[model samples]
Target: MKTEQLINALVADIGPRRSFLRSFVYATASGVAFDAVVFFAAIGPRPDIAAAAETWRFLFKFVVTLALAVPATTLAYRLAAPAMWRRCRFEVLMVPLCLLLAATAFELDLVPPSLWMVRLVGSNSVNCMTLIPVLALAPLTCFLILLRSGASCDPGLTGAVAGLAAGAIAATFYALNCFDDSPLFVITWYPIAMSTTAAGGYYGGRRFLTW
Candidate 1:
């Protein structure tokens, strides 16, 4: 083919870029709404939600999960682009992690050292581990769909961040129903559940996100 013809063909293939961040936000919102409906229908908030809301411990769970979700989502959108910014998006993830760690440390100092293990174990370790990922299913699927709309440099990483966002949002939903408000419990099990979904996203992205 002539050089001019090749240039014109390539130009024809180029199209206006879609906004990954906006698409992801819409997808995440849809997933959250779906989860909310399911939650209210089958798994309403804890019976003592009114009372629990008054406590800082109860509020802390939402705050931490939200904090994690925001930055992680931002990073996910960034990863969708071809040229990555040099900024350390991963470092932003540490802010919430360190906050939870600090809260856990404070709680340990205040409570009986002997009961530390009990707090860590909490009452619903099994449930938290199971439900967070279960609840994350819809959101993770939505995030993956959104991720596919973009030209991500690393599909696996993009998917993993999407999983993290899904898990964080799911955990936030679960916290309303969970009776265990201890920082120790939040610090431990939340990450495990998020990690499970993140791994799933990574593999799914690798298998399906290629052009």
Candidate 2:
């Protein structure tokens, strides 16, 4: 075809672009609501809600998860666009990591060296790992479905970010019932669980997100 003809055809094919932000909002909302229902149904909030709420450690958990979720959601939305990779500033994602690291360092300084392992391993390591992924399933599926409506040049990366968002959302819900609030626990196990979901999203994207 002639260059001009091809250009015209391409322009003609360009209908209304899907709104990444809108789709993400709907998917995340649905996922969060689902997580909430599952959480209240199976494992309600920590029994000592009043006591837990008073502690800085408990509150920080929300901060960490929200930190990951908000930026990841933004990044995921941008990544849905073919040329948006350059526009994404990942430094924002580092905020939560730095906060967690600072918190961990403070915790280490206050606690004995021998006890560091105890904090890292926390009581619900297995449960955290298990539940985060399980909770993420609904959100991840929703995110993948919504993402399919966009033009993702880097499907793997987009999916990974979507997974991060899903995992963060799941972790947020899980935090309500989880008794462990140590920075060490959040830094270590949380990432592992989130990474697992991200990996799942990456592979799922490769298999299902192709345009």
Candidate 3:
């Protein structure tokens, strides 16, 4: 059967909209909860969290991450249904992108040029890259399973969005533990980690989401 026909049939038989929404909520919540458990157990928040919270750089991490997370999650959920996928606007992601860019610019203007490389290659670059994806694994799996249940016309794209959401979620948690608060480090390293997860999602979508 053609992909459109399959999507139509899946939509017809996919039950009520509420069911999908409920499942989406549950799946995301459960996945985030699991990631949180792993974070607390393996690597709790930084010891200086209280003091760090006062700093604009530290607080801005959550601002950017959660900004990315909210829209990415919304887009991922919308993409689960092939009927709604096309209507989902990916431009929403630009909010976070612009925010990061602005912050990076501000950082560059405020900090000396000599320290640019130092801030960009923060002390925990290796750990930040490693842990974001590790933390995202559960959420990515949950999102892929959820996406599979619905019929996405563009499974690879849907999976990529799911991975983005999962990566953002993981990054939010990891931000608490990460000592690197510079927007320079975040812009440089966070994308590398999330892109890694998104690539995994794209490959998984191609392999499993096909009829």
Q: Cα RMSDs of all predictions?
A: 4.1, 3.8, 4.9
Instruction: Summarize candidate 2's per-residue lDDT along 98-211 as a digit string, tens digits.
Output: 999999999999889999999889899998999999999999999899888888998888888889889999999898888889899999999999999999989888877788
Best by TM-score: 3
Task: Go through the candidates in order and give each one's C-alpha lDDT.
Answer: 0.86, 0.88, 0.90
Give per-residue lDDT, candidate 2, residue 76: 84
lDDT by residue for model 3 (65-138), tens = 99999999999889878777667888989898899999999999999999999999989989988999999999
lDDT of 1: 0.86
TM-score ranking, best first: 3, 2, 1
Give me the runs in candidate 2 sitting further than 4 Å from their true place.
1-20
Instruction: List TM-score per model, in order.
Output: 0.89, 0.89, 0.92
Which stretches of candidate 1 lie above 4 Å from their native place?
1-19, 84-88
Which residue pairs overlap in candidate 3's backbone?
Answer: none
